[model samples]
Target: MNTLRSLTLAVSATLLGACTTLAPDYLRPDAPVASAWPGQTEAVAAPVAVADISWRDYFADARLRELIGIALENNRDLRVAALNIEKAQAQYRIQRADQFPSVALSGGQSAQRLPGDLTSSGESTISRQYSTTVGISAWELDFFGRVRSLRDQALETYLATEEARRSAQISLVAEVANAWLTLAADRELRDLARETWQTQQKSVDLTRRSFEAGAVSALDVRQAQSAMERARADAAQYASQVAKDENALAVLTGGQVPARLLPEKLIDAVTALAELPSGIPSEVLVRRPDVLQAERTLRAANANIGAARAAFFPSISLTATAGTASATLDGLFQAGSGTWTFVPQLTLPIFNAGALSASLDVAKVQREIQVAEYEKAIQSAFREVADALAERANLGEQLDARRNLVEASAESYRLSDARYRNGIDSYLVLLDAQRSRYAAEQELIAARLSEAGNRVALYKVMGGGWQ
Candidate 1:
């Protein structure tokens, strides 16, 4: 019995004296971001890389600038994302609160009376008990570092959500801009089709008059009519597409069609070419909110791994309660009436069917997944920039080619019409030339639109136009 008692006392003393924590040490995982393009491509030009410019400077079109402003004000997707950020902020605050002591103010009052039989014993006992406490209740000592790790994880998550919101904003802005540009381009094409149809109508009327005067054959008049009908059909088709684009743009701008933008010869018709700002590529990472958002996600995942590792060891918590309890209200303030209790608890899971191991495994797996996602995002960003850059570089050459074709077609169309009037060529020749001119004009508009579209994409990839 003595031996057993001694052993019991020794174990209890050892447990009481044990103060060292056994939590796992946290380490940040290394994530490498690739710098260069993976595939063969046009050499990226070194430019004066300036960081973070306002959207207004990037897009000089006054109407487009106004549209972006309204979208920013009313975009539903962006608003929802902002609200998510607030929720994340709250969650982070809650998580951080766990690391500090919880102080509370409590007060209570109660009254009790003994039965009538107790009155005969000595004196009837009617007591009123009132208590009030304002003190720190539970404060985790963080000897195991669980609270610290959790707090770090929460902070990372908050930052990640913030980045996510920014990413959403970037995407929304780009979509709205792209849609608006498309609408403009569509309108331009519609105008081209209308002009082409009018030109063909004049030609048809001249051919019919010449045919009645025996200056041209019925076949010539029929060909002219066919060409006019085709032009009218193309114009109608373009108009339909324009309407659809307008509706889509309306939705993107938060469901309000403020006003229809009139078609112009080109995007730069209003804005001077000198005002176009093609900022450098390297500095684009900072300007592009999505890239930063992706990086934050990676950081959040890194912190999560640390949080999970910290869960494997013992947790130490210190709970101290101090209150005044008195036999009588008169003695409540006396030192003898004050009572205090200090409790220190330590919990370590010894065997839990491999639950801790499983959690660690899951966390590690998640980290790996996040790493892959981060790398992929980086690669995608680079590729998008590369595509935009290549397209921008080739745009001048493409425009030159299209312009030459348009000039040649317009001259050939005039020559063929003159020859038909002089009865030197069949109406088929005139029809062919007119068809070529119409196609060239429409294609040229599309090519220019593509150029503008590429810039928008580049802007999106570079991170929302400078800042």
Candidate 2:
């Protein structure tokens, strides 16, 4: 018992001494972009961190929030991402188990018959044995930290998978919101087109009456008819577009879009998507899911390098069994039949045709690749946020200009219509004014849609709504 105790103490000491890891310590890579976001000025007020904002608070529309909830619950891609996390967790658990011994209960009985020539007796002999044991199989002792390094790698990989699930969730929310906005925009366009068609129809009727009274040429009547037909075609086209938009929204939501949730018009829809604060600190990019995932992958690759380095050192393994054995089943558990066995092994790679060296080289290169990928993710995120900021800054001015243009065009059409009624201008002048007014109306709607969509883009690129 004294010898066994001394041996166990020595083993424990060796294990503690050998727990050193060869993996390089992890340090977060520097941001690959500017310290402050582009266009960020000293006058700009510091804003709340996007990561701290919940999706519910970011999206003010209750209906949109409900739709997003359904998408989160039922989106197939998000489901797959979640399942991947579970699988990664299981994989990590399996790898971690290697760092410790696994004991199993085993039992066996054997009987054999020997020929007369092969046996001590000149007749056939029978041999029988019975044994029961609870012991560990060949378990690597982790004397070089190989098993521990592998377990660390598995842990990092699991963390990376969890970040990937978060990325999927962020993307799903953005998609659902965009899809909802698209339906609203298309519905607005359809309404605008139908209204234009009605106004043009009245113009055509007046032109036909003038022609019948011999007050205008048939050409005037044909011009009005042409404008009316174009409006009718547009109305039909927008009707189709609206239906397609609804179908797209339904597909995004993974079910029917609730009728009550549908925005009645573009103006109403735009009001629902409130502007997000844009003066966020650049450090928030570090918390972006994709960036975090990339960093975790880099850490995992770094851990793998440690495993590869540990491969150069000798490996130690142990196998042991303690049980009772007897020639007959009746005596298997007898005190006199007690038995024990232990085997320890050491493996040194004296020659491997450069396999170990090659493995280490591969691991180092993989870590470098992951480092580059992590930087690239940060750069891409920076660009996304920058683009959104730039758009957000200018979209309001553009919308204002478009609204002014629409008003001016409306006044021009009204004056042209009055002139034509008094025979002070030709039908051609009235037709041109009508075309201008129709175009300005369409542009105004487009401008409004763009302004609204920019808000969603800002929320998405800033990594908002995934708290």
Candidate 3:
């Protein structure tokens, strides 16, 4: 009993001493990106970081907020991401369990018949035996921290999966917002086309009347009819685009969108997406879910190297049982029937055809790959933000210029129409002015849509919508 007690204490001490991991200390790789965004003149202080802001607060429209909420609940990709996290968690748990011994209780009975020549007493005999044991079978002791390192790797993998889910959520929210805005923009364009068609039809009717009365040439009536037909074609095209946009939004949201929640025009949607703050590149990129996921994956690879290193050392395992045995079932638990076993195994790598060394090399190479991938993720994130910022810097001025063009073209059309009515200008001048005004109106709608879409892009790249 004293020998058994000392042996148990010694094993416990050895296990406690093996707490440290063989993996190298983790150090985060430097971010491979520029310090500042291109064309950034100065640092801008923002009241709130993009990551700190919730999607609900970022979008001002109540209807848009509701739609995002519904999409969050129904998006299939998000559900898959969530399931992946669960699977990773289970895998981590399984790995962690390897660090502990698995104890089991077993009971059995056996009987054997012997012939007279084979029996010790030289007589035919029947033998019966009964036994019960509680034991841990072939449990690795983790003397070299191999099991610990594997558990750490699994933990990092689970964390990476969680970040992946966060990334999917961010993408889903941004996609829904962009799709909603696109539908609104298409609807606005469709309405503009319809309005232009109606106005052009009125012009065609007036020109035909003048031609019949000998006040205008037949060419003028044909020109007006041609303009009206162009508007009719645009109207049909825009109507089709609007329907396609609706279908896209329905697929993104995972179901048909409520009519009341749908956007009516770009003018309304322009106010739906709020402005995002330009945070420092390093701080913002680190907060991004995709970037964080990459870093976690790198950490997991680092842990794998430790496990590989541990594999080059000796491993120890133990298979132990404590039980009672007797010739009869009733005597199985008698004092004299008590029996015990303790088998310890030690394995040192003597020769393996270099497989162990090759495995360690592979782990090191994989860690290098993860480091590169981590840096790449940061670079990609930086580029996305920079692109969005560059667009945002120009979008305001572009929108203003488009509005001015629309105003100027509308005035030009009004003046030319008055001149043609008073016989001061020809119908050709009036026709050109009408065409310019219609084009300017359409361009203005496009500008508004561009500005709104740019804001959505900024929100997504800045990692604002996931919250």
Candidate 4:
């Protein structure tokens, strides 16, 4: 009874000391970065957060939402991230177990035979015995919070993995949207190319007629023919690009390309939540996943420092066993046949070639490194948001100018064609106008597409879709 009470007292004392953690309390590192982005803060009007809406609600295209769903369910990267969480969880279990005693069932059997040469004792004198005991074996008691610190580290790592999975989801959604946008744009350009080809074909036929009647030279006829063929080549290339981009999107979605994607229009892929979302710089630290992941990692690192520091102190462990052992099976359940033992151990490090000290040093350095990385992540996230917003505003202005150019080109081409037919303008004049009109039309398409893409990018930067 005294021994049991003494063991209990020791355990309580050890725990009292073990509960204190040596790691410094974690604080968010202050980053002295610029608050306002160049030419963006005051100049750009504050827009409502269009990115804050749920991805499904924002991306109203039923087909796009479906594709994103499939990718989230089947993406190999997400599965890997989940597996990593499982691994970290297992490690946490192992470390937690280290804080308590481990019990094992042990048995022993022996038979001794003596040589006949030693006759007095050897008269085939053999001894046989069997014993079995269930007892706690060697275990480390957490007397300095080492095991607890390790558990904290493991938990943080597990959460970090979860964040990584979310990050993958965010990136996967963005990629599918961008690729879908590209596919749609390519389709639109292909249609434009076909239109140009048809127009050029008409001009080519007219030139051929004029050439046969000696109204125009063979060189003129050849130039018109060349223009028509170029347009056909452009159309073919656009068709090929569109097909390839669709296949790429299909692969990401883990299926073959559908006959047609939903929304039927690229602009419908993403609905802007805000015409201009407010960019409050302070919230950026929490909004970005990579930044969150970095901070968690840093926290884990800080816990490791505590774990390493604890290694310099002694480890206290308590083990007790109460079981029955007897030579004969008949005596196994006897009332007074039980045996018991209690052991308390304390081990202090003596010498280890400075290995423990080196580990502590490494952990401290790693903590510093994570601090820097965390700061860098925050700065990088802020810059991406700034750049996206700048593009969104500037692209809007450029798009307006481009709209005017498209109209002017269309008018010039029409007039040039009439003048050429009336012999008031040369075929060269018509050719120049056709080239300018075609280029202008293509640019207009690109500008519109750019505006849509910019919105998606801004959404991503402003912490929009990961939720």
lDDT per residue for candidate 4 within 1-467, as digits (tens), equals 35655776677676766477677799989764665665644533345453356678767577777777877777777778778878888887887777666768877666777777766754667666666667666656676788888888887887788777767777788888788778877888888999999989998998999989988888888888888998999999998998798778877777775665633335633553545454566565465677788888999999999999999999877777666667676766676667778887888999999999999999999999999998998888778877886777688689889989999999999999899889898888888899999999889888878887787776677666776
Q: Write the per-residue lDDT of candidate 3 for residues 238-337, one digit (tens) a residue.
A: 8999889889878878899999999898753444435677867888889999999999999999999989999888888898888889999999977899
* lDDT against the true structure, each candidate: 0.69, 0.84, 0.88, 0.77
Candidate 3 ranges beyond 4 A from true positions: 1-6, 41-46, 268-274
Q: Supply the TM-score for candidate 2.
A: 0.94
- Writing each residue's lDDT as its tens digit, candidate 2 over 14-115 gives 887868788988888777787677876543444676766888877767888888998888877888999999999999999999877788989899999999
| Clashes (N, CA, C under 3 Å) per candidate | 3, 0, 0, 6
Q: lDDT, candidate 3, residue 293? A: 97
How do the candidates rank by TM-score, highest first?
A: 3, 2, 4, 1
**Candidate 3: residue 322 lDDT (0-100):** 82
Q: Report the lDDT tens digits of candidate 1 across residue range 1-467.
A: 24433543454365436423332344433334334433433335335342254667667687887887777878888788889889989998999888566767665667899876777776678878766554555555665556666676677778877778777767776787778778887888888888888988898898789889887789878888888898899889988998898788777777767664433446744222332344434445544566566666656666666656667767666555556766466666776655555566778878989888888788778767876776666666766776776777788799889989999999998899798768788878878888899889888888877877776676677765424
Q: Which RMSD does model 1 reach against the true structure? A: 6.7
On lDDT, the candidate that comes out on top is 3
Alpha-carbon RMSD, each predicted model:
6.7, 2.2, 1.8, 3.0
Which scores higher on lDDT, 2 or 4?
2
